[model samples]
Target: MYLRLENISKRFNSFVANHNISFSVDAGKIHGILGENGAGKTTLMNIISGLYQPDTGKIYLEDKPVKITSPKGAIKLGIGMVYQHFMLVPQLTVTENIIMGTENSWCLNLRQKQEEIAALSQAYGLKIDPAAQVENLPVGTQQRVEILKVLYRQAQLLILDEPTAVLTPTEVESLINILRQLAGAGKTIIFISHKLEEVINLCDTVTVLRRSKVVATTIAKEVTPQQLAELMVGREVVLQVNKSASVPGKVIVSVQNLSVANDRGIPAVSNVSFQLRAGEILGIAGVDGNGQRELADAIAGVRSIINGKIEFNRSCTRQKIGYIPEDRQKIGLVLQFSIAQNLILKAFKNLPFCHHFLLQPPAINNHAQVAMAEFDIRATGEDIKVSQLSGGNQQKVVLARELAGEPNLIIAMQPTRGLDVGATAAVHSRLLVERDRGAAILYISTELEEVMAMSDRIAVIYRGEFVAILDAEIATIEEIGLLMGRGTGGRKSAGTG
Candidate 1:
């Protein structure tokens, strides 16, 4: 075994993060770890990467027992981890970020170091300009820089947590190829992701953890995505949504020649046009940071539209729309507020939640009680701050607040971004319920599978434009992916054409 754990356990006060977890990885092989959020997958990875010390465990490397005290200590043990969110400085060059601490800054030769790093990248099939700024690179290229950063430190063991979460389909393929090359050259990899298909397709062996315990470890080739889902959630999961054919009603909102600028005042959404009806879901699918934010923000009435026409249904006003922003913590809810306050955010000035600028605690608490029970938000009480809740409960709070009234239009952006399987299913079920209730929903997500599974009509966005708008029932992943990569519609069919 290249790496092994003997009855590893960790605890933070009364909560058990990892419980006697034991697993091994073969040398130069990719080992996948699967789990729901808060299932101790991250805890285990943190222990291995020396961010935390296991309360009770023995980690064996090359058949010898070792203790990792800190991240630098872990690095000295030839272990490195690339987090889902990159830690590179945006203003630094790729070479600078890679060799930030590896060499003495005062005595460093910039050109010589860049050439060495360039050679290392080429050897591992990770091609990038050493002198290019980190922020100027694409998401996939940034990920390659992260990997090269690890390997540059002579790390033989690699831990990647949710590596493909934000990557495009093309970028995902490129990463898989790069990992294979690294493994062939004798690097042990531990792959962690919520994506079951990716784990099955790339990992040699897979381990599933549930409720802070190892449920199973099996050969990747022997298990299906459904089986893996079951192992991860401890129940049969509905990986696909089952819905009747959408009865799309009259157009709830129509957009023409829309153009919007990002936070930097540069055009992010360009000349995009579409009509969303009262029942069907129009899913905007693309890679992360690909104009999804600006487009959604414009429709939600949160950001200014540089040049466009957004007409609501004669009976539907902008105030009647429910907007679920992508970042729930930042835009959706106030962390310091109680559940009661958060639930009534949109209608705080209304009769039930408030009256004459004098807060109505009784009505607010009563409303929260109803919303919590209805939305299945598992919190100690309505008085507890929103920050104390889990990611799922936090999302439920957002959903409860947004879906308070029977809004005619809903703008949902990456609603299930950080949620686990059960929570994901809940979000989907609630959105589908609203869709059935004749609500026009614009669902934007970086997750391609999620967009396809949830939408009635699929709009493939590329370079701030809708390259292809196809009927979800007839669209293939290949067709959508091609449109995304090509970044142009060409002769492809467009919105309801």
Candidate 2:
């Protein structure tokens, strides 16, 4: 075995993050650690990468036990980790970022280091400009720079956490190819992801972790996606959403000639128009970096549009639209607040919990308790900090809070991005229920399967344009894939706006 974790365990206060987990990976192979959000997968990888000291356990590299007390120690032992969030300084150039901590003198060896970085990028099929600033690069290229940072450090074992969560389908395929090439060149890869299809396609072996324990490990080729889902959740998994056909009613939201600019002052969405009806779920599918973010933000009243008209239904006069942003930490909820506090974010001012000038703490707690119970949020109490909950449970809090407002429209962006099988199912069920109750939903996601399964009508967004709209019942994966590519010779369908 190239790497073996023997009885690794960790705890924080009274919560056991990792419970005596054991697993091993071979040399020059891609080993996947599969688990739901907060299933101790990150904790295990952090322990091996020296970010945390395990309460009890040993890590073996090449069958030799080593004590990795810090990140620097792990680097010296040939173990490197790339975090879910990129670590590069935004203002630094690519070459500077890669050679930030090198031993060579900057004044004397700057040119040589630049050459080395260029050579490494070429060798790994990462076409990145060395002089480009990190902030100016696309997310896909930034990811490549992260990989280059680890490779430049001469790491033999690379641990990646949720590497493709924000990537488009095309970029995801490129990443899989890159990993395969790295493994082909005798590097060991420990990939952590929640996407089952990607895991089955890219990994040689898979280890399933559930609630801080390794439940099963098997060859990736021998297991189906269903089997892997079952192993990860410890039950029979249903990969499909069960929703009856919807007879969409009157328009809930109408957008006319909407246009929005990107961060660089370029038009990211141009002259886009659509109508969302009550009792209907309209899914927008697209590659990452498309206008999905801008479009969703425009509809949710978060972003100012250059030219547009937005009309919400008359019944929703009391409650504004609810928006579940793609980056939960940045826009969805306040991580430092408690569950009870976050539950009152938008509705605090206009509630029974507010009386003239005083806030009613007891009423707020009561509302929070009811939400937690209804949503099955696994938190200790209303006083427990939101950040203390697992990623899945944190998402549940966001969902519970937003849905409790009884909004007429819900703009859910990547709602189930990093959730495990059970949580994904729960989210799907909630959306279906909302649809049945006549709430208009705008579901924006990079996962085509999800868009196809839950939507009544599907719109494909490509490069600042709504390229095509098709009925969900008639759209095939191949059709959507072609639309995503925006190639020269694919069937172009008309918009149903």
Task: Evaluate all candidate structures by whole-model CA lDDT and list the values in order.
Answer: 0.91, 0.86
User: Which portions of model 2 miss their true places by more than 4 Å?
Assistant: 89-93, 108-114, 127-138, 261-267, 318-320, 482-490
* Clashing pairs for predicted structure model 2, backbone only: none
Write one digit per residue (lDDT tens) for candidate 1, span 1-497. 89999899999899889999999999999999998877889999999999999999899999999999999999999999999999999999999999988785677899998999999999999999999999988889999999999999999999999999898788899999999999999999999988888889999999999989999999998999989888888888888888778999999999999999999999999999899998999998888887999999998888999998988998788778888999999999999999999998888888976688888999999999999999999888999999878788999999998987789999999999977777888899999999999999999998888889999999988889888788888887777766776675434665552
lDDT of 2 by residue, 1-497 (tens): 89998999899888888998888999999999998777788888888898999999888899999898999999988898988789999999999898788766536576777888899999988889888899888677799999999999999999999898766566777888999999999999999887888898999999999888889989998999899898888888787799999989989898888899977888999877788998999999887778989898888877888997888788765365778888777788899999999988887886677889678999999999999999988887998989888777888888998888677898999998778888898889988998898889999998788999999988888777777777898888877876876622345654545
For all predicted structures, in order, the TM-scores are 0.95, 0.90
Off by over 4 Å in 1: 489-491
Model 1: colliding residue pairs: none
Candidate 1, residue 271: CA error in Å? 1.6
Candidate 2 global Cα RMSD: 2.7
